[model samples]
Target: MGCDGGTIPKRHELVKGPKKVEKVDKNAELAAKWKYCALSQEKLRRPIVACELGKLYNKDAIIEYLLDKSAERPNTDAVTHIRGTKDIKELNLTDNPEWQGERRSAKGDRYEDIHCGMFICPVVGLEMNGKHRFCYLQTCGCVFSDRALKEVKTEICHKCGDPFQNTDIVVLNGTKEEVEKLREKMEERRRAKAKTKKSKKSKAAESASTPSEAKDDTEVDEVRNGSLENGDESSQSDKAGSSGASRLSSSFNGGVPNLATSKRSIQEMEEKSEAFKSIFTTHSSAKRTKDQTSNWVTHTPYHF
Candidate 1:
C-alpha cells in the first residue's frame, strides 16, 4: 500500500513487498555474476595459438578443452582438424561436420597469465598498480601489453552483444572433477604420443646419417647353438684330427687305415728288435777275432 493515497484513508507502506523486491534484485545480481557472455572461442594449435592468444597456458587449456570435450555446447565453437586419411564422409555418417576453430582474449585466467604474461599480473597487480601484460608461459619471451589482460568475473568484451542463441545456458554441466581427470588423461596420452614420435624420429635420423645404425636387439642371439655332438663341422673335424686323439674314433672301427696302421707299427717294432740283436751278435764276434789276433803265447813262440 502507498503512503500517498487519496482522500478517504491514509495507507501504510508495504514493507513486505519492498523486501521481496530487494531479495529478487539480490538473487538476480548473484545469477548475473556467473553469467558468461559467449563472445568468442577461437582455437589454434599450441605455438600457433600461443602466437595468437598471447601465452602458453591459454594454448594448453584450449587444447585440453577441445580434446577432452569435442562436443561443442550452444555458446561454444569447435575448432578441430583431422590428420587421418579417412575423409569426413567415411569417418562418421551422422557427424560429418568439419569443425571450425574459435579464439578469445578473455585471454585466459591467472593460470594463463602467470605462465604466459608480464612482470606483474592480477595476483601481483593487486599488490601494485600500473602493470604491463607479459608472458609467464615458459615459451612466451616478453611482456606484450597491459590492456589485453582482463578480469574473468566482471568485465566482458561487449563485442558479445549479439545473442546467437542464448536460450540455453549449459548450466556448467558436468563435474569439474571429471574435466580435470580428462585433462590429466589427455596430457598423459599426449606425452606418450610425443615420446613415441620422438623415438621414431631419432631412429630415422640415425638411420639417415649412419647406415649401420644399431638396432635395439643387439644383445640377443640369432639362434641357439646346436648340441655338443652336433656342433660346427669344422670344429668337429679339427677335434678328430688333433694329436693324442682317441684311437676309438668312428673311422677306426672297421677301416683299411686301421689295419694298415697296425701292420706298420708291428713291422717297425720287429725290425728294430732284429737290428739290435744283430748288432750285439756282430760286436761279440768282432771282439773274439781281435782276441785271437792279439794272443800273447803266439807272439812269444820259443819261450814255452
Candidate 2:
C-alpha cells in the first residue's frame, strides 16, 4: 500500500524467521546472497548490500528509469517482505517527492548508490574532494565512519529525504524561529549604527561652533573696552578746552592782547577730537600690535 487517505493503523505482521524481500536485480540477489537482512538469517553479521542505483544514475533519462525501477521496487518488497527505503530520497521534498511512489523516508536507501550506474559502491565513506561532505544515508546508517557527524553535516542521506544534519539528526529542517532571530539581529545592528551616527554628528557640530563663539565673545569685549576708553579721553579733552578758553578770556580782560584766535583754536580742537574719535576703533589686538611694531617709525610724528 498506499497511506493516502487516512491513518490505517496498519500493522506489520511480526515474523519469527528471516523473510526474503526480492528486489528486481538478479545480480543483487547473486551478490548479496551471502549476506542477509538483520531480521533475516543473519542479524549479527556485517550488513551486506548491493548498491545498484549508483550504476544507473548516469543515464540522461534517469526519471523514466526510476519509474520503471519503482515498478520493480514494489515487487521487490512483496517478494522480500522488507520495509521501503529509509530517509534518503534525492529530489527536493516539496517537488518530485516520489519517484514511482517511493519516499525518501523509506526504511532503506536502496536507490542512492547510483552514480551513472557505476560499479558497485563501497560500503565505507564517500566524501567530496574538499572534505566537506560524506555519505551516511540509508545505504550506510551512520556506521563505522571517521567523524560520522562531520560527514552528515556535509553529506546527503537517503533516510530523511534531506541533506544530513550531521550524523545525529538527518532532517534538521530549516525552522521559522531561526530565520526570525537572524532578522532581529540585523535590525538591532542597524539601530545601533544609527544611534552612533547621530551622536557623532552632534559632537561634530558642537566642536565646530566652539571656536567661532569664543572669537565673537572676544570681539564684543574689545569693542566695549574701546567705547569706555573713548568716553574717558573725550571728557578729559573737553575739560582742558574749557580751561584754555577761560584763561584766554581772563588774560584778554586783564590787558593781554585781544586774542580773537582763541575761539578758532577751540574749533580746531573740536575737529581734531572728532578725527581722533575714529582712531579709537576696536581693531583686532593682534593686527593692531603687528602694525604698530612694524611701523614704529611711521608713528613717531603722531605719537610725539
Candidate 3:
C-alpha cells in the first residue's frame, strides 16, 4: 500500500551497472588522419604539404600559421617547430584510378566499393588506407607502401624513376622506431651541409684578407725611392748654405771663407738639430782621428 508520496527510481538510476567502454570509431579516425589537414583539421585538398614527422597538412593552413603564430588554433603543438615555408615540402600525390571523388557515390549506389582509396601506390596495387603501412620519398615526393619497396628492392622510384637512397624514404604515421631512424638521417645530412658552408666561408675570408705578391713588391720599391730622394735634398741644402756664407765673407772683408771651416760649422749645426741627426750620423762620431778643437768654430753668424 502507498502511504507516503515517493518517487519511483528508474532501473538505470537505481541499479549500478558496469561502466560502458568508449567505443572508438576506426573509420572516422582513419579519415581524419588521411583526408584532413593535421594543423587546421580541414579537409585535405590540392597543394598538400607534410612535415618531418610525416603529418599531412594543407599548404594554405601552414602559411596562415606562419603569418600569425599568436592566433589560437586547435593544433598549436603540432606545428610549433615549423618556422617558415622551407620547413615543409609540397607533396606530389598520385590519384587513385578508381577514385570518383563526388561522382562515384553521390547517389549512394549500393554497388560502389566502400574500401576504395583516394590515393594509391603506383608500384603496387595496394591502397593507402590505414589497413596497410605507407611511406613517401622526401627527395621525390613519391608515395608507396613499405611492402612494395621491400618486395621490388630497387633504388629508383617506380613511378618517376628518380634515384633515391634509404634515408630519403619516410614512413607516414610510422612507428616509434621508424620515426627515430628518419630523424637521425635528417640530422646527419644537415650537419654535413653546415660543415661545407662553414668551409666555404673560411676560404672566402682568407682570399679577401691576403694581398697579392705584386702589391708587396711595389710598396717596398716606393720606400727605397723615398729615402734616396731625401738624401739628395739634404746634400744640396748643405752646399747652398756653405756657398752663401763664403760669398758674404768675400764681399765684407775682401777675403773668401775657408771651405773646410764652413763645412765643420754646418756639420755642428746639423748635429744639434734632431732632424739632421736622425737622417745621418754626426761627422765627429764618424771621424777616426782625435777631436780637433782648434779647427772648430764655437760661434757663427748663421744659426742654421
Candidate 4:
C-alpha cells in the first residue's frame, strides 16, 4: 500500500520507534518543595512566612501582593485566602552552618553534597533535606526534625521555650494523612472562635437594649428630683420675703415688732376680712362683685 509515485518514500523511512520515557529527578523535586517558596517559585529567603494551610512563602512577596491586590500575578490562586499580614506567621528559621549557599555550587568539585540542607534542627542536629520528616511549631514557627520532638517530648518549644500542643506542630511537606489531620484541626479552631465571638456579640446586644422597667425607674427618679428642687426654691423665696417685710416694718415704725407679735397681727387682720377663709385655702384680697356675692349667697352660707 506504499505510494507508487516517483517521489514516494519506502515503509522503513516513514516508520517511527517507540517514544522514550522522561526521567524525573527526585533530588530536584525534593529541593523545590523544601528550598523554594510555594507562591513565587523562587528560592526561600529570610523572613519566610507560612499560611494556615502550611504552605511556605517569602515574606516580601506576600507583602507586595497585599499592598497591590489588583496587580496581575501568575500564582494568584496560591495565596487567595491570605487577606492580611495576620494570615501568615513569619518563620524563625535557623541558619545551617554547613550550607555554603550559591558559592558551594561555584566550586565545581568532583563530588557535590546534593543532600546538603539550608537548615538543621537545633536540638538533634538533623539535616532538613527531605530525607527525614520535619515539623514546625505554629506558636513560634520554629522548625525541628520530627525525631527530635518525639524523643524529647516536652510541652515547651525546644528552640524558643514557647508552650505548644500536639495540634500546633504542623508537619512540613507531610503525607496526605498528616495534611488532612491538620485541616480538621484548623476548621475546629475556627469554628470555636466564631462561636465565642457570636456569644459575646449577643451579650453586648442584650446589655444595650435595657428593659422598660429600668426606663420607668429612671423617669420616677427624675420626677422626684424635680419636686425636691421646687420645694427648696419655695422655702428659699419665703425666707427672703419674711426678711424684707421685717426690714420695711422697722424702717416705718421706728423699730421692728417682736417676731411672734407680728405673726399674730397678720393672722388677726386676715381673719377680719370678708374674703378670709382657711389659711391653706384660696381667699379674695379685694371685695367681691354683686354677681359673685349673689351666686355665693345662693350656693351656701358665706363664711369668711
Position 241, candidate 4: lDDT: 95
The best-first sequence of candidates by TM-score reads 4, 3, 2, 1
| Candidate 1 lDDT over residue span 1-304, tens digit each | 4435564442443233334333455434322221221112332222322211111223444445445565544433322321221101110001112221133345456332212211233232321112222322212222212233333322222223222221111111124564355346445755899899999999999878674433323323233333443567768788766733665454576544554446554334443565464444333333443444545555422211
lDDT of 1 at 153: 22
Candidate 1 Cα outliers beyond 4 Å, as residue runs: 1-52, 55-64, 78-209, 213-270, 274-304
- The numbered model that scores best in lDDT is 4
lDDT of 4 by residue, 1-304 (tens): 6565767786668998787899989999889878998877889988888877777889999999999999987688978878899878887877789998887555566677878999899999989899998888889899889999999999999888999998888888777787677778877987998999999999988877766668889999989998999999999999999999888667667453555555554435533554344442234433456665764355543454
Better of 2 and 4 by lDDT: 4
Better of 3 and 4 by lDDT: 4
Worst 10 residues of 1 by lDDT: 87-96
Runs of candidate 2 with Cα error greater than 4 angstroms are 1-192, 246-254, 258-304
Displacement of residue 39 (Cα, Å) in model 2 is 49
* Alpha-carbon runs more than 4 Å astray in model 4: 1-24, 105-107, 211-216, 221-304
Query: Quick one: how many clashes does candidate 4 have?
Result: 0
1-304 per-residue lDDT for model 3 (tens digits): 3435776767898699999999979788787888889999998888988877788899999999999999999999988767788768887787888887776546656676656778888778788777788888888888888899999999999888899998777788767787677677767876898999999999998787666666788889988987898888888889988998887667666454555556555455533675565444444444333353344766431211
User: TM-score, each model?
Assistant: 0.22, 0.25, 0.63, 0.65
Task: State model 2's lDDT.
Answer: 0.39
Number of the top-ranking candidate, with TM-score as the measure: 4
What are the clashing pairs of model 3? Answer: none
The total number of steric clashes, by the backbone 3 Å criterion, in model 1 comes to 19
Cα displacement (angstroms), candidate 2, residue 231, comes to 1.5
